[model samples]
Target: MPKSKKRAKAAPASKAAAAQTGLSRRSVLGGGAIGSALVLGGGFWGISSFRTYAAEHDLSRVGDGTLAVVQIHDPQCPTCTALQKQTRRALRALDGCGLTYLVADIKTPEGAAFARRFNAPHVTLLLFDGQGGLHRRVQGLQQAAALEEVFSAHKAALT
Candidate 1:
């Protein structure tokens, strides 16, 4: 009786199969760790860049005897558009209040940095007093009545 040669051929085939798979335990783990490190590093770099940009730009526009309504938003955002409409309605209602409205596009690097510096969320509304002090901060979508109330409360400073 002849012993089968199949078992002898199987050993080399198994080694070839392992080579085709190409990845070892160490390589996969190491690659994953390196990839994660790169992602984290990139995130930190982005944050640093935003901070630097914010520091370079002058965000304080309201000066003595002037009132400012700063709206930080993304033009493409539906919520921001809605907020703009609501803000316009509010401003119309308070026609006599000598307030200035400034729209900052968050898509720009400067805008992004400004929002971060002020800790404002997307579609944020910031009210500044004549002295350039932040009087109120509103985050997210706001109703016309709510915005009007804020303006009304700051009317004395605005005029």
Candidate 2:
């Protein structure tokens, strides 16, 4: 005589656009998470691909019959940046000195190998003679005057 409980009416989905389109709440959340992961991953990849530290280095020419000064660099280190500023000032002061200024950015494989090969750490400077032989290794943050003196002495030794 009475209607059965199993024959109850269904919930309303006839008016909602998402319900009409057959999209579920779980699916929507999943899609949003995937999209966010992809965007963040791409952004991280882009940042690393075009890193700014020593971006213009050419390690191949380091030993090409020229006296050289190489800085073991790390882009994310504050002390390394300070050392870089000091090195730059010294180089500018010693302009026309035939000493090739180079950077071995540890972020790159070649640069990392170079640093390892010489046992050099970040914020260190390597002085190379005309034949690319290691002459001196100076470590830590240095004043422009001190760097200039070192550069000048090394340059004089080569000449």
**Highest TM-score: which candidate?**
2
lDDT of candidate 1 over 1-159, digit per residue (tens): 134577778867877876899866688899999999999999999999887645423455555457888788888999998998899899998885787777666888877887887888778898888887788888888899999988888866456
Per-residue lDDT tens digits for candidate 2, residues 1-159, read 235433332234332656778778888899999999999999998888656333437777677898888999998999999999999898899888788788898988988999999999999999998777999999999999999999999988778
- Model 1 global lDDT (CA atoms, 0 to 1): 0.80
TM-score of each: 0.58, 0.65
Native-to-model Cα distance after best TM-score fit, residue 35 in candidate 1, in Å: 61
Task: Estimate the overall C-alpha local distance difference test score of candidate 2.
Answer: 0.85
The worst-scoring run of ten residues by lDDT in candidate 2 lies at: 6-15
Report per-prediction Cα RMSD to one decimal: 13.0, 9.1
Model 2: which residue pairs collide? none
